[model samples]
Target: MDPRARPFRSVLYIPGSKERALEKAKTLPVDAIIFDLEDAVAVEEKPAARSLLTETLKAGGYGPRFKIVRVNGLDTEWGRKDVQAMAFAGADAVLLPKVEKTAQLDELSEMLPGMPLWAMMETPRGILNADALAAHPRLEGFVMGTNDLAKELGCRFRPDRLAMMSSLTHCLLAARAHGVVAVDGVYNAFKDEEGLMAECEQGRDLGFDGKTLIHPAQVPTANAAFAPSEEEIDLARRQIAAFEEAEKNGQGVAVVDGRIVENLHIVTARETLAKAAAIAQLEAST
Candidate 1:
């Protein structure tokens, strides 16, 4: 993955067992769809869900939409099969739930030679070994599973999520250190649009590349929150122009909007412009 490229800001979860939901999701504007075979599927439905997800991938038309399969953990009976099917499905990535060690990643790397592995940092052990897990060569990214983390830690789900903020930040830091994208977990209250926006902003502020969403209603909010606004884009353009002009004049830095603009600022501005352009292209295509 390109380090400068913006990731899926809104990764919608679609139950692998629900054919209707899966089909509908393919037409949505979500950057990625996580076809879930773990918690979303009932014990008896796992096999069917696996088959459906496999077939859906084979019948491709999801245009620019990234596909990821959330498989059962390695400890489960269906886990091995899920890995085998996903490996052959040619998915963009495989989401491994409850990953707690680099050894698990090693096993997955052996199974799927070149496919990216997205680890869910939800369990206590997973969080503890986050740095090591992130260092794995096949590790592409991580999805913060706040709900499970809260339950495992015996912490209450407060509106502010103060209890988990530190842990969440740590995860982001580890991912950044390893040059991997880190996404914030889903905001459960699908009806609370205001609350969802606030959380989305908070996640962006905390350095998350994007967020996992549980519903389609949250897509616009996630996109807006993670996208570069008009004002930001204009500022970035101005900064880039100023720095380029300074270089032309044999100057090391330039003043932009009464503030000094340096090489670092220009780099950031270029990245911001790239993100804005990527988002614009994505919107235009949809």
Candidate 2:
């Protein structure tokens, strides 16, 4: 499936060191899971977590959710080993944190060969060089790291996220320009459903493919926010019908709800229905 078309409405991150969390994730309705061996795993526990996570993945029963293993930087001792294990552990992709350069991707690409790689857009340098990082051949997706970015900028967090829009927008643009999926970062307060929904809606409107989740509670909200609504699906159907009828009648446009519906509108209309259908198919499988 095209990365753009994939239903990544909710990509949950689970700490690899936590067996209970990993097991609990099996029952979640999330679209993707990022099994973390990076910051989520402590310095001393990295090796054990790597081994345990690999074994858990090997005993696979994750079903339809895309499985991603997040590895530490290549400079870290556990990173290469993590990649080696994940390559054969049935993961869909390996995620790299704080990726700022294309060369980092190149090095991993050479090492992993055919593995799909997802980049974490966290550092200022990562956002600045997003185009270059996204342009890497093996790069398939970009996940924003908002907390790290906030720390890097020394900015106060606001519900509106006004301080980070430029960086976020640039990273998103780079991902889209490079034809890769872009997922927004997590909303820190897992218990704050209202806040999470608002952020998910904002991210969807801002052209993100989905949001990276920190908790299972956030999954359904993100999924609902990103998926095409019933109203949108219904309108898309009408628009497509009207446009097709107009085309048959040798007209360049169609009238729907007293508004002009052209080929451009029909294109988006079709996309809406397609996305809705894709979501349905995914849910059915899940």
TM-score of each: 0.97, 0.98
Write down the RMSD of candidate 1 (Cα, Å). 1.2
Q: List model 2 lDDT by residue over 1-286, tens digit each.
A: 5677778999999999999998999999999999999988999999999999999999998898899899988998888898888878889999999898998999889878888999999999999999998888899999999999999999999989999999999998898898999999999999999999999999999999899999898998999999998889889999999999999999999999999999899889988888898889888888
TM-score of 2: 0.98
lDDT of 2: 0.92
In lDDT terms, how accurate is model 1? 0.89
Q: Could you give candidate 1's per-residue lDDT for residues 1-286 as a string of tens digits? A: 5532755788899999999998898779988888899999999999999999899888987888878899999889999999999988868899999999999999988988989889999998999888998899889889999999999999988878899998898888899889888989999999999999999999998989889999999999999999888999999999988889999999999998899999999888988888888877877776
Best by TM-score: 2
Off by over 4 Å in 2: none
lDDT: which candidate is best? 2
Evaluated at residue 258, the lDDT of candidate 2 is 97
**Could you tally the backbone clashes for each prediction?**
0, 0
